[model samples]
Target: MNTQIKGRTISLRLVRKEDAKFIYSLRNNKEYNQHLSQASGTVKDQELWINEYKNRENKGAEYYFIIERLDNEKRIGTLRLYDFIGNKESFCWGSWILNQDKTRSSAIESAMLVYEFAFKELHFASCHFDVRKKNINVIKFHKKFGAEITNETNLDLFFQLTKTSYGDFFTRNNKFIEN
Candidate 1:
């Protein structure tokens, strides 16, 4: 799709084959993988997955984005939007991980970029995520965006943000984002 979302602290670009190794390492990293779905095997495995993903007929079905530092353009992590619900009117957001050096503000900035892409660019009615039950950090993070816990399985907790709720959130929190 050759798309990029530029944010104040980071930007998101479509995943490319060149990012296979970086993604593989990030997916397997212990520090970040506890609640994350593990990506085992090798970088070649990731390459194969990427190849298959790129071949999907509907690119909107899955948007895999590499998150990079705006300052030096260093690829730090990734965020993916998928599992479209309500006839692609809404989607599930996941596959997010940021470098340890990136602070909470950086995470928020990256999320702001993702929400902007989902709600503004894609015009999706809602965006949500399934967070692993044990990932308290991320669960709390999602709550800050006013994402309500909607459903739960033994392993995961799902949260969603409606377009209206999201807009209202930004209106209330513009001060925090300004500086």
Candidate 2:
């Protein structure tokens, strides 16, 4: 997989077909499914999904990335930007990050870096994320990144960050920090 974004201690890259096994293992972990878009099923089912995802050609519906720790080059998680809708001037985005216990924070940081790439490099007008209402920790983390709650239903809470807003956030949060 070619590296797409590299942070101080993490790397994000395109998911390859060879990664199906790794994805299979991680997706089966119950903890990883808590906030996932879909539930895990049999191994055959997971494999089928991975194959379809690997073969999918529609740029309009999905984009996937694998998150790895730089120190050991370990595949710890995956992130996806989905439901693309709009013109060149504007688009909507959503993502997911999943990892085992020890690498959870790194996964989150990698996700933030990917989001930076999405808004800054890709020139997306806005990015959004939806979380299950029960995932309080993730909700808090999104708040720390300056995401605001825009809508809530019985099942989910939606958060959004416009390019203008995220630019200010990136500046303020890194003003004194050195890589």
Candidate 3:
């Protein structure tokens, strides 16, 4: 699916094969890899992974997006949706703002765009994520989006956000004015 989500500071587009190097660099960051299930390595490895990701049937897997700075179109992060076990729900995962110099707001904005896409465009009943337990900032960030902890493993916390709750959050936040 050719799709794009525009945020105040960034735009998210489907991951392209051309993005292998950029993605490899971001995923190699020790801080970023701690939260990811798989470790990423060389550009060649990233290319192989992208090939598999692109060919996967949408019947189960949904979307994977590349987050880019709107001003200069520099690739910075990635967002993925998968594990569509049913019609109403799916798993959401992303790594944003790999640039250490960037503000947290950029990552948050990218996530909000993905959330909107999942709940609004895709019509998912709920979107969920598994975050590393030690990632306090991520847990708090998910909470800001009204996600609740549903389950926990030794190293991860599983969180869920229902469509209704997402709508309510936007209502209360009075529309996200992207900066």
Candidate 4:
């Protein structure tokens, strides 16, 4: 797996120990975490979580990344590709969090980077992720990517997207970010 993925306005690189603080902050920030499961851990606990995840990440069971602004080089978000499924050709995507100040357009570019990395770089056939039913904004955002709601649980809705759909989304919308 590639360690770094660059888009027109953002970059995604492997998460490091130093990111524990940022991860802790993002995971605990109400604006970003309220719709998701709460992360209950101290910074030391977060560091250990990073170490444990490092091994799993290296084995390709998961990919964790820190998102940074390309122009100013400011770290603004986090992302992950995990939960490898049947045939291992599809995976769940989550851990998407960005600082509020940078969400205007960088959010789109950041997600595009992950999609490009998964469908193009890793040759993954599709990707799936769950969003809380109440997170309407994010649900709408996923729909913009041609993701279809494939399932629903009491508290969450699952969206799935094939590589072809992702490709066509950008092609039709004319929003393809430079690789």
Candidate 5:
């Protein structure tokens, strides 16, 4: 599988131990951390965590990505793909956090890239994830991408997007992913 997935304006590369500082900053950024699980500890802790994560990555159990702008090659965001289910028929992805100061396109492009990697590269039939109930904007974003809400709880809403649904979304949003 490819280590880096490039899009029209941005690319996603596997997270390395060296990215601990950046990841730590993003995890603690008030603007982006509201909807995410609380992250604590120093950059050293993050580095240690990444060291362990690398082993899972090697075993094909999970993937964490650092999103960067292709023009300047600056790291701008982070996302992860994990929680494989149904014998590779579906996968769960979360930990999506992006810099607020950057262009909004980063959000769209990063998501497009994730779906591309999951479906095209990993051959997963569908993507399933949960969004915090209070994260309305993200809920809308997934709905617009044709993800169906399958369940909801006190804290989160679960959604699913099949490959067919993504194919349809791709047809409509081709500009974001096309050359």
Candidate 6:
């Protein structure tokens, strides 16, 4: 697979071993990490995890990406697509975090690129993911992008966005991602 998906202002590229520190910083940054799963261990541990993640990435099991600015190549966020279900029928994406000082469009462009890669390149039928109830902003963000809440637990809400719905979203917001 081509490891990089480019958008107008931001791009998603495969995470590398060298990205351990960046990833660690984002996960440990209190401003951004509150809604995310707690990441424990040192940067060395993160590197070890990336080593294993590389193996899975090579096997087409999962993908982790670094979202970076086009003009300066500065990484601003991270997200992953994994937990595929039912023979590529659906995939779950999480570990999404952005810098507190990130560019205004990084979040939107990163999401557009992810869905573009998933629906167009990978041919997935839908996306499935869960958001912590505390992450209200992210929940609203996904809803605005056409994801529907299918289920919920006490702590999290599960969402599903079919490719068809994503097509509508893409059409409505295409200009934001135009090259």
RMSD of 3: 2.3
Q: Per-residue lDDT for 115 in model 3? A: 72
Tens-digit lDDT string for candidate 3 (51-148): 88877734437677887777788777777777775766565655543565343457667777877877777778888778889989988988988999
* Model 6, span 74-114: residue lDDT tens: 98889999998887799999999888656788888888888
TM-score-based ranking: 6, 5, 4, 1, 3, 2
**Clash pairs for candidate 5:** none
Kindly report which residue stretches of model 5 are placed more than 4 angstroms away from their true locations once superposed.
none
lDDT to native, each model: 0.81, 0.68, 0.74, 0.86, 0.91, 0.91
Question: What is the number of backbone collisions in each predicted candidate, taken in the order shown?
Answer: 0, 0, 0, 0, 0, 0
- Across residues 1-179, which tens digit of lDDT does each residue of candidate 2 receive? 22468776677787776777777777667766766676557656656776687655244345677878777888877777665557534444444555653353574566567567677666678777688899888888778777889999999999887777766767776432215
lDDT of 4 at 59: 83
Query: Which residue pairs of candidate 3 clash?
Result: none
Winner by lDDT between candidate 5 and candidate 1: 5
Winner on lDDT between 1 and 3 is: 1
Can you write out model 5's per-residue Cα lDDT over 1-179, one digit (the tens) per residue?
A: 68888888889999999999999999998988999999989999999999999999999999999999888888999999999988679999999988854556888889999998899888999999999999999999999999999999999999999999999988889798665
Which model, 1 or 5, shows the larger TM-score? 5
For model 1, the run of ten residues with the poorest summed lDDT: 170-179
CA lDDT, candidate 2, residue 29: 70
Q: What does candidate 4's lDDT look like per residue over 1-179, in tens digits?
A: 66778877778899999999989988988878888788996999999999999999878788999998878878999988899887757988898888965746787888888788888777889999999999999999999899999999999998999999988987765454664
lDDT of 2: 0.68
lDDT of 2 at 106: 77
After superposing candidate 6 on the true structure, give the runs of residues whose Cα lies further than 4 Å from its correct spot.
Answer: none
Let me know the TM-score candidate 3 reaches against the reference structure. 0.87
Candidate 4: C-alpha RMSD to true structure equals 1.5
